[model samples]
Target: MTDPIYAIPDIHGQDALLDEALERVARDGGPQATIVFLGDLVDRGPDSRAVIERLMQGQAEGRPWRVLRGNHDQMLLDFLDRSVIHSPRVASGLSWLNPRLGGAETLASYGVTAPDPEAAHAEARAAVPQAHRDWLARLPLWHEAGPLLFVHAGLRPGVALDRQDPDDLMWIRAGFLDHAEPHPWLVVHGHTALDHPAHFGTRIDLDGGAGFGRPLWPAVFEGRGCWLLTDSGREPLTPAE
Candidate 1:
């Protein structure tokens, strides 16, 4: 039998939940199975630093996994850079490290106290280890396997994959979420919060609002369909019958 591809949606600094979800994946797919992390690894929840450390350790130990970048992750990097003031698109006017966007929580996870935004940014840049920053910098925006496309966010409709803007890939919502047209390949994405996984025929949204006190939904895909890899067992996912 072919090994299934497992996807873990937005973690949002919840290391404990992430550990639980990963344990479920291991039980179902074993050590050799392919795993993809659909980004937003930091911000909002506690222990964002530890979350990145765990993933980095996995990569070091030779785990077959891919970590895609989300808007939140990009925000953290932009905040650290010092050269960049604001996010290019969706979060344009907002400072990349604005506390309102969960930057304070993430910075605190790395041992930087956010008494003031500017001061916190400097402290965070100094506190975060270079290795962690390198890993974050190298995270890819997308990954493809068979007919599926794994991304942090949905793709814009009618745009070819190569021509799709990086801004859309990291920050788009309305146009990408509302469109019903089939994509070139089935897209698996996170970023948008949902009470449960939303499985459109052409895409699957695995963001279960883990950042908002919901469960982290990890799933496995084989052929053209998917199943939620829950603590109990595998539950098939399909959009309303």
Candidate 2:
């Protein structure tokens, strides 16, 4: 059997689901199996702070886990460090704290509340621990292991890996998602959530919209094939032709 590398994607602040997914991973792959987190670890749910702390604690315990930065994660950092409410990467002036984006829920996870936007910023700054900010800032945009290349969002097709824009890695959708050609590596990502994991010939998207109250399923890759890791066992994922 090929050695398995597990991946969890777009956690989006659902600590309960995160816990269940981690347990499933451990049950299937043992304690030392390499796990890649494809970003979006915050917002859209009720417990972003707990989610961050759990990942941090796992890494500190010396687990072979790689965490990538997602657009939501970046938005949180921007709000805390620069007071940037709206992201230029997104259109329609969609601020991070917009109800749809779920930034308010993240702030609540940190026990932060304020009377106004200005006060919110200051309160968030004081409430969020410096270590979390440091960890979020240090997360890489992508990770490569053998034939697998992991990212938060899909990459821009035709751009070389080194030349890919950071924003595109975390926020892009159009070209990357619609592209029919295979990427440099079998790109594993989670940004565009589907009712289930999507297996295009070139990429596998593991985001099952845990933030939207759907299930958060972890997937494992071995060579070019994939499977959804569940409590019972592995469920094979066939690529779309």
Best by TM-score: 2
Tens-digit lDDT track for model 1 on 1-241? 5568999999999999999999999899897678999999998899899999999999899999899989899888887876354665744487645544667788889888867677886787789998888899999898988889999988888888888887688888989888888888889999988998989888899999999889998899996679998778999999876
Alpha carbon RMSD to native, model 2 = 1.2
Q: Which residue pairs in candidate 1 collide?
A: none
Candidate 2 lDDT over 1-241, as tens digits, reads 5688999999999999998998899898898989999999999899999999999999999999999999999999999999888888777787788878989999999988774668899999999999999999999999998888999998889888899999999998998898988777999999999999988878888998898999998998888788998878999988865
- lDDT agreement with native, every candidate: 0.86, 0.91
lDDT at 58, model 1 = 92
Ten-residue stretch with the least lDDT total in model 1: 83-92
Decoy 1 TM-score against native: 0.93
Q: Report lDDT (Cα) of residue 112, candidate 1.
A: 89
Alpha-carbon TM-score of each model against the true structure: 0.93, 0.97
Q: Please report the candidate that would top lDDT against the real structure.
A: 2
